[model samples]
Target: MEKVTREEEIDEIEKIRMTLGAHLEELRRRVVYSIIAIVLCFVFCWFFKVQILDIAKKPHRFAMGKAGLSSELQVLSYQEGFYAYMKLCFITSVFIAYPFVIYQIWQFVRAGLYKKEKKYILLFLPISYLAFVVGGVFGYFLLIPFGLQFLIGILGPGIQPIITMQQYVSFVFMLTVALGLVFQLPLVMLLLSKIGIVSPDKFIAWRKYAILVIFIIAAIVTPPDPFTQTMTAVPMIILYELGILIARPTKKGFILLGTAVGCGAIAVVGVYFYFTHRGGEINVSNPYGDIQILYPGDRGWKKVSGHMSFQKGITLKTGKGGRTVLSTKKGVNVGMDTNTEAHFFDSWKMQLKTGQILISMKESEIPLEVDTPNGRIRMNKGTLNIQAKDIVTIVTAVNGEATLLIEGEEKKLLEGRQHKMSIGGEPVDIGAIINWSEGIVTKSDEQK
Candidate 1:
């Protein structure tokens, strides 16, 4: 009898190996399918690459609208050009192929689950996908724009602001993926709960720890502004609470809807504030930096100092004082002083923080670039219309007849006939135009 039992045990072991082999084969097949699908999607995305990039730029576009401005931001590399589209394609493909990938994952594990539990795993596929996409949208739509605007607007005049596509794309990618994954907390916790691996009671008990984690996560994910970080943390905390609340309850699908509605309301308010206030952050990398204070009605410029590190874009060119123009992969803060002649530029960026940027152009021929049309340069004056992408050209006419040379055809924008008085010793707009790039800015009288 003992011999017979041993033989039977060996047979059972062999059968288990066979089952494992079958499952492994299925996993391999699924992986191949996923790879193929991703490749196909990426190729397809490459076709409509421009469109994808346009979508990625919407946040910046929205922020620029307040000043009736548009930017013709350029990418420096040839091979790495069209980077935004590449990022969009990659991200979109992951999402597009997720359902199939999840199905494959489920198939690999389903044999181990009892018939009763298999459906839950299958259902989780869509839930996880939806939650992530929603989170990504929320972040892109609400938080990123405001954070960018606040930081950029703070860098005021004597600095010609320039941003690269690489940094922007990376930012969008990180935020979208991070937020999408985070938003899946409830579903993930629910699954663990149903499996008896995690108890709702225990989760509630350890809520404080969770809050700390949320704060840390908020800091990691949001831009380095306390305001933006706090805003994100509050929502995440609220979401955690909602997850806890729902973790205990009956089969109420409406719970998610209610939670979503509340989240939506908060997001709406956040969006409104972001648009109404924040404009864009500045990237400054200057050694000999100075600030300027220009009032609506003043005479000359003053030199005030500033504190900025770098969000992005540092050149190799030595300053007149010979300083390194550093670039930031994340962003760094450096401290410097700026003189007062830069007030006009600074004030332009600062007006966004308070709401609208109001500066009377007076009787002068300043070059103006409008995003609404190509080569639409003008001697901008009289309550100049502003909107997202409205101002893309440079306004350059300290003297009479601001000649706009766009698209090979120079249009005499505003006839250069009058010189507007320089507002000297005007209070500097702290959160306005403070950036330092080579060439884009002519030396301010105050800097001299």
Candidate 2:
């Protein structure tokens, strides 16, 4: 009887050893599959980069203004635009194909876990997806809007808001992703605690420490500003506290003691970077490198090396000689009187409804002409001759000065201002053409 019992025990021990060995092989196989999938997905994303860029820019096109209002503006350098959009594409491809990735991970880990644990983890798959989506939603719908509005509102008056498509898109996406990951804290804690990694008592004891760190994180994630930083920080702190509760293990101690404190400190540093500008006093510079069209709602900018001439908008129109209408508009509205010189011609043609107007001035080089049916604007500079007659006209300047000629005679309009001198023209009581480049300034929610 003793010998029979000994043989049975040996058999049972061997069975257990073989199970573990089998599990390890399964794990290796699944990991290999996951790596292969990611590589394939990344390669695919690279091939279709242009298509990916269009999607990433969708949010900016919608939020910046109406689609017909302006052309898409890229905030980064030429290289930056190419790379940033690629990064966006890679991230999106990974996310969209994440389910397959997760499934591969599960197949490897599944066999090692008991049936009950496997079932429970399977539930986590969907929950993880939900958490990610929720995080992104919180960022796009809530955090970004508030932050953007706050930055713009601060500009108040005397500023032209020129936000680039690249900057705008990147900023919104960053906030969305950061907030989404932050929202997944509870799930992360639950998993860690369930695995005997962290104990409940340890979490309760370190609650205060976690609270301090949460504020720090909030500061880092938000755009730098008292209103935005504090708002972002508070929620993060709350989430951290919630994380502790979720992670609390009744029997064991905490595991990520350092991670908790470290992430918190990082948050604070990020917030600090956001708010303080030019010795901690706020001054607006172009966030879009050399482009100075930063609107009132944007955050303070770093001192860019040089000026950025942001392409606010571009329009191709068919006129007598062909008009290239551009601004933050589909086309610029020009107004002029036949008697007006370059000075009066340079005055921005008011949207006439909104207080805003278009300022147009000529360059000394690129040859151009201005003529319309309204009154007319006459200007003379260098080798240019500007003439208008039929009705009132708005003049668009390229890079030359026009010799002002009115009613078959000649007169001095005014001198040309340097820069892409876009000044408003005077509109008749008849009204201004609703061109693409101008609008009445309006305040957004964050500014409020």
Candidate 3:
């Protein structure tokens, strides 16, 4: 009997060892597949290095245009350009092969997860890829351009910009990779929430602290300027808020309330647009006090009162007690509150230099785009209330929907939701929308 028991114990040990060996083999296989995918992607990116380089150089060109300087990036060392090209190819390859790597990782991890959790693996994989791409685009298009311009501008006039190929490539790569990782904010929050590590309530409670930390991070990552720092922080804050919203426990009552509010707000905006068919011009229906308008070639701001035509490259400023409302031909309306500064870069682009502006527009062929220190906002048919204060920009979607492009990702802001983005860094949804148009320069929120 003793001999039989010992033999059985030996058999059980052998089985355990076999299971361990099997897991190791599976891991090795996944690693090999991931490596193969990366190598293939690397070769493809290397082949298109010239095109990639051109694309990367766009922001630099834009910055130079803004600064009124024209120069090509230099190469100090004999192989500097070659090394830079190789680095770019490798980075691009990683981005291209990221999805396959994620798949391999998911395959390895899926074994330990339950069937329900397995669904998340599939969802996360695509989202991960999308987030990375969005982040890369954000770095390439917005942040890098603005940052390079600002840095060049601060150097003052007559100082020609000279950048090394290696330096430029490294800068671009660091910004792209950092943003790509940062854009994973939502996914990380969702995963933690799913595992019961964090909840929506916890995120809400930590709001103020999070804002502080976000700014600190922005200052560290971005160039030492309020604009760049605010830009970076805005997107991060928005992402954090989105994470909270995603993690929040779903409630039928809350959804119903939000739906009701959204419908009401939409109806109000629709009615306002229907009655006032004024083409893109400032409406002085009830001007609070006096305001100033500065034309592109004007020497100084001119005091204005009541109903002015909206023109491209026009600057509007409101004094301590002044208020104004401007509208576009496409039924796009902008209401500037007291102590606000706004510049219409073009018909489609408006920059909120400082203070608050409420925008309401119906879905049309022409999209109204607003630029702030944080990022860019594109609206079609939506009522958006944005406030710029210090280093933060608060955006609340009163009705319809708007798209926020920051850090290479486009986030949809739906009605009945409030989002806050750091003018320097990230973005977050702060929960239910409030009455943000209480004391607007245009029509009151209740009237709207």
Best by lDDT: 3
For all predicted structures, in order, the TM-scores are 0.57, 0.49, 0.52
Summarize candidate 3's per-residue lDDT along 191-223 as a digit string, tens digits: 877877787677778989998998998887776
lDDT of each: 0.55, 0.49, 0.76
- Please give the lDDT score for candidate 3: 0.76
What would the per-residue lDDT of candidate 1 be over residues 78-118, giving only the tens digit for each residue? 85566656777887778677777777777667655644466
RMSD to native, candidate 1: 18.8
Candidate 1 residue 23 Cα shift, in angstroms, is 3.7
Q: Which stretches of candidate 1 lie over 4 Å from their true place?
A: 1-20, 67-69, 82-84, 250-271, 277-448
Query: Residue 144 lDDT in model 3?
Result: 81
- Candidate that scores best on TM-score: 1
> Cα miss at 375, model 1 (Å)?
23
- Over 29-96, each residue of candidate 2 has an lDDT whose tens digit, in order, gives 87788777777887888888778766655544433322112325646566877767666766766667
RMSD of each: 18.8, 18.3, 25.4
